[model samples]
Target chain A: MSNLSKPIPPAGDQDALEVEIRGKTFRGADGDAVRAIDEIAFSVAPGSFATLIGPSGCGKTTTLRIILGLDREFDGRLKLPAGGGRIAAVFQEPRLLPWRTVEENVRLALSDEDTGRDLDDLFAVLGLAEMRSRYPGELSLGLARRAALARAFAIRPSLLVLDEPFVSLDEQTASRLRTLLTDVWSARPTTALMVTHNLREAVQLSDRIIFLTERPARMRGVYDITTPRADRDARWREATLPALAKRYSGVL
Target chain B: MAPDHRADATDTALLQRPAALGRPVFGPRLVTALSLAGLLALWWIAAIVADSRVLPAPPAVAEAFWRDAATGELFFHLAMTLMRVIAAFVLAMAIGSVIGIVLGMNREANRFFDPWLILFLNIPALVVIVLAYIWFGLNEAAAIGAIAVNKIPNVVVTMREGARTLDRDLEEMASVYRFSAGRTLRHVVLPQLQPYFAAASRTGISLIWKIALVVELLGRSNGVGFQINLYFQLFDVAAILAYTLAFVAVMLTIEFLLVQPFEAHSTRWRPRRAGS
Candidate 1:
């Protein structure tokens, strides 16, 4: 078990989110009490990437929902960043409107039509250039996921929340999507929080990693991935995450 | 379940050769035309067997239709009935859709009015039409109001189901992006409800026309149903058959030309389920 040490950011970034969760208890359909999350607290600096890694059913998605303000029924305090910018989320499913084409789905997030050129560029970058007219039902799951990403980043969100974006894809497609995500995030820097189960993905994409315990979720461990983005390659993950895995034991 | 020959032929035709736009194969159309010819033959035989003026031959009814249409009386009555249908359909859809969305969005309102909706839905169209004429005195307003009231409750039920089935995940997407209410409605809410609207409008038009006929017969003059009643009093069987066939032709035109195309446009994005 890790000790409760609040993540204090640099003195200048004092206004970033310091999420202090006291408890979140939910009852199952049968009226039996289920402890989904016990107690947790952490802080994330503005404009940095943080990944939450935990076992399946550890309520990582729940915590993301709480942060996004979709699930306010949870317990504890979420100190949103000062002067909150726009927030956007990519849920586990694409959740695109089946009737709307890919372009329409992406355009739904955009309020200013002046970003038309940028939208075009975003579509090209995501390999969705030719798919603009196709409906979600027509696209393969990977393409649909890319369309989802386009919709998320098209808004130019200040706080982009991704919940297991690469789940259930072929490893090849997942890597491609991850690379696209990295390029897009680099082009438009935003504070992002991702929930993924893949340790290698957590190590490669995040500035810091927060490991969570199983149900009645609490912070199990936190690690800083000091490898810079250009050098955070597969070798680096192979070299580092196993040692970190031992340090956090079974949480990873 | 009973076998549906049209659907069976269309399905095999779809599989063997995906036609340009799901147009039924020519074989089925020929079959249908022959089937209709056979129906005419049967009716002709029946009229001969009865050998009474009660059931006139098809050619006599055709002559009656030609005479009525040439005099323009049939067209006039059809126009009157159609005008009432259009008015009642629009009014019911507008008012019922608003009430339904209100009930769906607000839990307390839904709780309060759900029972009332059930009560109104169960009320008979005839009773409502009679009550409307009694309360408002056989005026055009009462006639249209009665038809609209009979249709509104059904629309409410349909639209309420539509509102409830709206995807929550997409709503959360809208919220996380902070989309404006107008944009949310146009892009998110309305698209999801398209199928429901399609269902409502398609069925609503059918229901409105039937109720309109009842109202016209019970109260109004110079409409198809009223004209039919007048012919009935005169015992002109050939005229009755001519009017019925003309009305059926108009209804078929509306169904095939208007409602069917709209249905295709709305649900085109989805894949073909079993028989559609």
Candidate 2:
């Protein structure tokens, strides 16, 4: 069991987000009360990458939804950064409007003031420059996911939430996209909290990994990967993953 | 193998075969021309055989059409009927789409109004027209109102189904991005409902035009329907057929030039099928 201590941020960055969820319950179709999240309390330091790791049926996504304000039924308090920072998310599915072109879909996410950001650079980074006029139905799953990522980052969101964005893709495509995700995040790093089940991905992409127990999930443990992102090469991952896996064997 | 029929065919004859797989030898345009010509030939044959006052020959009908066009009476009646169609169609589509979206989104309202929708749907157009005339007294407003009333329930039924099937995921995305209500409706909601709007309009045009004629026949005096009625009373079958064909031609033109092209444009994002 992890204690409820807010992590210290680096100098000059103090507006870390604190999420405290006492309980979350859902009523099944049969009208029985089912607890989805027993309790989850964690703080994501500003500019830090945090990944929520848990089993499939565990309530990782439920917690993410609550924090994103998509579901308000849970008992929780999410203290966003001062000045009410903007939040954006990439859902499990791409969720792009099928009728609109890719450019339009991304443009819809931007507020009027967001026009100052150079969308062309974002498109170039995601390799979606030529795909701006295409419809979502015309793209493959991987390309559609790339478009979804572009929409999320186009807003320059302060809190970027990703809900299993790269799930179900082939290994090659998924790996390529992970590299792109890190590149975009580094270009304009924000406080990001991603929900994924892949432990290796968590090790590669996150500064901190929050482990949760299975259904009616609770924070089981927290691991800090102090290794800088650039040095987490294949050889480093080969050595570090098994040690972390053995330490948090139950949650992993 | 059977003899290669393509080797002997002319270039123009071979034009239709390779462009579309599994299509008939004749192109669609050519088939449409043939079908219309066939109907004309059948009518000509029937006129020759009967040689009666009711069954006029092709030339007689054509002469009546030309006479009406020459006097500009055809244009007058045709314009009057077209105005009514446009007015009633716009009114019914506007009011019905709003009501349908509201009902579809609200369970309580839908339940309360379900019986009313059923009643309106079951009521015959004639009864509505008669009631409107009796209450409002025979006039353009009453006539157009009655036509719209008959068509509103149909648009409501279609738009309600459309609203019910809107994608929830996309809606959530819109809200999460803080899109304004107007923006959400324009980009997220309207695109999803377009096919249903097209469906309602296609059926609305056909249904409203038929009811418009009835309204004119019962009360109004300036439309093509009135002309047909007057010809019927005088036992001038050729004149009646001429007016009927003229109005039908206009409706067909609207269907092709407006309704169908809009439908194709709306669904252009979908993958193409073999024939469509």
Listed models, DockQ each: 0.60, 0.64
Across B159-258, the per-residue lDDT of candidate 2 in tens digits comes to: 9999999898899899888888999999999999998998899899989898999999999988988998998999989988998899999999998788
Top candidate on lDDT is: 2
User: Model 2 chain B, poorest ten-residue lDDT window?
Assistant: B1-10
Candidate 2 local lDDT, residue B197: 95
Which model scores highest in TM-score? 2
TM-score of each candidate? 0.90, 0.92
Interface RMSD of each: 1.3, 1.0
- Model 2 lDDT, full chain set: 0.87
**Model 1 iRMSD vs. native:** 1.3
Name the docking class for model 2. Answer: medium
